[model samples]
Target: DAGVTQSPTHLIKTRGQQVTLRCSPKSGHDTVSWYQQALGQGPQFIFQYYEEEERQRGNFPDRFSGHQFPNYSSELNVNALLLGDSALYLCASSQMLAGGDEQYFGPGTRLTVT
Candidate 1:
């Protein structure tokens, strides 16, 4: 019954550096999605992974990338980070069904770029 979990609850980095975030999906979940949320804004989709493949992506730049493991866990990677990249990185998990799919989000990793 464990829920989605993220690592390094808080991270601070200098501009132009790279960072990687980790996520473990909830039990019985098969799909994983990544989102970015600014301080006062709602979560914006980064990308989604299912069957170890990227199923969908958002309007993010090429610097954003991700991977889904066979166990349904996932990792989000950002390269050439910029100051504007500071935000909360959220990981959500859900079982993709024909209908009635409910997604549960993780606590989120706070990223600060200087």
Candidate 2:
């Protein structure tokens, strides 16, 4: 019955550190996707998970990783963070329907790398 949810609404970290963000998918949804939105730019797809497996990935480096849980929740991890990595991280959930997949987005986690 819940929509997508993300934790630690905001975060601050120093360069070269690591951070992990968490998300819970909406009820009846089976897919989770992550996106990064930099200032003055549109969101960029980070990766997607379906059936607890990574289904798609974007142009980010290996420093970006994610995991999808059996319960359809997810986590996004960034390692060796850089100042440029600072951005708003969003989590979206979707489910396949007769029409198409309908996606719902969560309030993003704002990450600031110092």
Candidate 3:
């Protein structure tokens, strides 16, 4: 089965433009999480989606939002992008249990805001 898939392997935007990235979780998976990784930094959890609802979120601004579909696919939307927002946006997929670990991550969508 497909592990996870992300669109536009790379993306570029200006300081104030918006961008939307897509992700498809692995087969049989019900949870999708978004992460941001800057250069020389570890992935920071952005938010998590399960059962078509946002279950958990990280310490990101309101500009970062996401949605999950019934089919387990997801989308990450960033509004009023800033240069600081430029990072490797990663999409991770995992099962929803009482407490689970080890999420499968996609290559990532590299976003650069000039």
Local distance difference test, candidate 1:
0.94
Per-residue accuracy of model 2 over 5-110 as CA lDDT, tens digit each? 9998999999999999999988888889999999999999999998889989999999999998889899999999999999999998988452226679999999
Task: Write model 1 residue lDDT over 1-114, tens digit each, in one string.
Answer: 889999989999999999999999989889999999999999999999999999999999999999999999999999999999999999999988734168889999999999
By TM-score, how accurate is candidate 1?
A: 0.96
Locate the minimum summed-lDDT window of 10 residues in model 3. 94-103
Lowest lDDT block of 10, candidate 2 = 94-103
Cα deviation in Å at residue 48, candidate 3? Answer: 0.3
- Model 1's number of clashes is 0
Query: Mind sharing the TM-score for model 2?
Result: 0.95
In model 2, the runs with Cα more than 4 Å from the true position are 97-100
Which of 2 and 3 is ahead in TM-score? 3
lDDT of 3: 0.92
Error of 3 at 45 (Å): 0.6
Q: Which residue runs does candidate 3 get wrong by more than 4 Å?
A: none
Candidate 3 lDDT at 44 equals 96
